[model samples]
Target: MTHTSTAQTTTDEFIRLGLDVLDTELTAIDGLRRYIDADFAHACELLLACTGRVIVIGMGKSGHIGGKIAATLASTGTPAFFVHPGEASHGDLGMITAADVVIAISNSGETNEVLSIAPLIKRRGVRLIGMTGNPQSTLADLADVHVCIAVEKEACPLGLAPTSSTTATLVMGDALAVALLHARGFTADDFALSHPGGSLGRRLLLHIHDVMHKGERIPLVDESATISQALLEMSRKGLGMTGITDAGGKLLGVFTDGDLRRILDQRLDVHQTPIAQVMTRQPITISADVLAAQGLKLMEDRKINGLFAVDADGYPQGALNMHDLLKAGVL
Candidate 1:
């Protein structure tokens, strides 16, 4: 009983500590609003007008944060990359060109590695934007534009770990990247171009034509075909559905496995009944140019599992189903 009571007390203390850390970090982030002033705008303008890439540099925990910031910027339509301050001093400094803009990050604003390369970076006639906690420190003074990310206190109990300050820096980086993205009128299509391997890219870039069955693969039957013939076509094509078309090759209707089940009790003569008599007329059809994602939504909205891609004149061009979308990674 005593051990259980002690364990409960320890758990409660841990929860309290976790909550306190969250509150501290929240307060630190909230305090950053005042710092997003004209200086911040100026830094963004400089970056926006830059003809070359944006170079991000930092030390220690700030380096990790800087790397993420650079990635976010690059992915969000801004061309940016991270270079370690220590590496910049050795040889990576060659990566920065005169037309490029440099963003230097340091919590103390006095990191020796970062400060060591500041003069050399300036000598290249490159614009320098500094992000630091100390607005009055040497890095801030040396920078052409200084964005202060001062936090009231660290979330760490000992006040030594970089907790609130790093969070503020990351948020600031996002703000810059998003602001630039909006200013440049970056579209989802543009984002997909950079992230073609991601799911969003597949949804945006893959079209019905890209994933649909074409040529002889499309499950199709003449309107005059009997229900049994339509079933044969559906089976041969393996799409669980068949497009019923007229003699002129214009799509008239569609017959699916669901239709087969529904008419099972009707006792209709499969060999004698025409497919057009039992098929779904004016069924939901997608254009060959439509996005695969849009096709997925149409199927979901109409409670369907398959679709036929039709041309402008209602000619069946191709066919696809949920499984095709899954195979294409669009699902």
Candidate 2:
């Protein structure tokens, strides 16, 4: 009864099309379960036994998938790289070594560039693992190990584009990398080591020292400093809190904006009142090596908004506030 505009119809059609593509890919990966033949195990075994690296080679769309798999493997504790099959004939094949394992991928299993290097890879004493839709094709026939990435059909309406086949290949590569990761006892720390420039790295590698203000820049004062002096220090450092230390430089308490408000409510004179009178005694402090996320958790659990960084002798050495977390993108 309703007439939809062409734009709206196109929008709906594309959304449905994308969902169909994802569903088709899921089904293809599920189908791989039945093909759990010895060929798959043999491929993994050859890669695991390799002494050097896993070199991935493919052409066209399959080449794109191979490149992504290579990057994934490289970042996940497995040494790998993608060498375009087209480039292998252009002198880049010299990058290949006898100690490497070769993974050749093709949907038709007869890509000329990929197949051309199969014999050379074998002649160099490298293990050849093939991922293909056709188990009987030339590339698979020449491989020492064949992995079937057969898809029932393409997500494309005409079954022309590579949708399900690429998904199956990616899933297989992930399986290999994760299995090898567990075999090598790779950990989250190891992952952080490989990704030290990203936010995930910052979350894992950052410590209190990296974010907390230290030295004279820290917001700190002696117990004898007046409330007015502490507030000045807090404002100067912009951390919203000041650490109150004893005569021996040991952490005695902390004074924050909250404490100031409470003192003001009691009509306390800032200029004459000693910071010790309004400071929170035995305030929660963190060590220099504490993680930023852990620090956030500690503050949240304690119902506090700030922290003092302390040393081995309970002496305050640095100060941090909620704003610091926000600035560091940890909030």
Q: What is the TM-score of each candidate against the true structure?
A: 0.94, 0.87
Best by lDDT: 1
| Model 2: residue 295 alpha-carbon error in angstroms | 2.8
Model 1 clash pairs are: none
lDDT of 2 at 68: 91
For 140-248, candidate 1 gives per-residue lDDT tens digits of 9999999999999999989999999999999999888998999889998898888899788999899999999999999999999999999999999999999999999
What does candidate 2 score on TM?
Answer: 0.87
Model 1 RMSD in Å is 3.2
TM-score of model 1 vs. true structure: 0.94
In order, candidate lDDTs are 0.94, 0.86
